[model samples]
Target: MSVMVAVPDSAEGALALTSAIAEARLLGTDVLAVNLGLRPISPEHLMSGETRITILERTHHESHAEVVLHALAEHPETERLVIGVKRRSKVGKALIGSVSQTLLLEADVPILAVKLPH
Candidate 1:
């Protein structure tokens, strides 16, 4: 089993990545990181001797939520999905759908939602 995380180019994403790595270490499993950012994640910065991390690139055609869900479906060994979330107004969420919300509702696997410290 492995831990999966959706990593975007934001502070929340960074926290989620760090949290996923820590959780994987505890679970004694590897990490499957789905990169949702426009730019690729730096493997050298994320890699550690204790845990193995594999970064999956996002296709141009796929939505952020789709990419994450697809990765989970592809990797049946994924024990958990880690995602970073921030507060959003109801109006904002209504106007712009939330990826985290979609994952929370649709993902078949367990989800670990992390947030930045105020």
Candidate 2:
């Protein structure tokens, strides 16, 4: 089995993703950490090899979900997906939208979400 993790350009998101990757390893699932940074292929900040990391450029300003879906469309070989979501209180949740929420709702494969520690 395999999993895709959406990693944004933030340290907290990265840490959460690393935790999710560790969990995937324990679960025997291959990890694919997708870094949709400001530009494509900016794999410089992250370590190499321990996890399968792929950095992609944003295809559209409003089409991030579609970009992710298209990227993983060929993952018939994978089993699941993972993403990181920053924890938020009721008021916070009311303000900021969540990518993890959208992915969980739309992805054809099962989605797993890791949140920033409270």
- Candidate with top TM-score is 1
Put down candidate 2 lDDT per residue, 1-118, tens digits, no spaces: 6666676777655765676567666776656666666744334545534655544445666555666776678566556776766767999788877666777787898776766666
- Prediction-by-prediction clash tally: 0, 0
* Candidate 1: stretches off by over 4 Å: none
lDDT per residue for candidate 1 within 20-107, as digits (tens), equals 9999999999999899998888665496678999988887578889999999888999999999998888889889888999999999
Local distance difference test, per candidate?
A: 0.91, 0.65
TM-score for each predicted model, relative to the true structure: 0.91, 0.69
State the lDDT at 89 in candidate 2.
Answer: 90
Please report the candidate that would top lDDT against the real structure: 1
Residue 61 lDDT, candidate 1, scale 0-100: 74
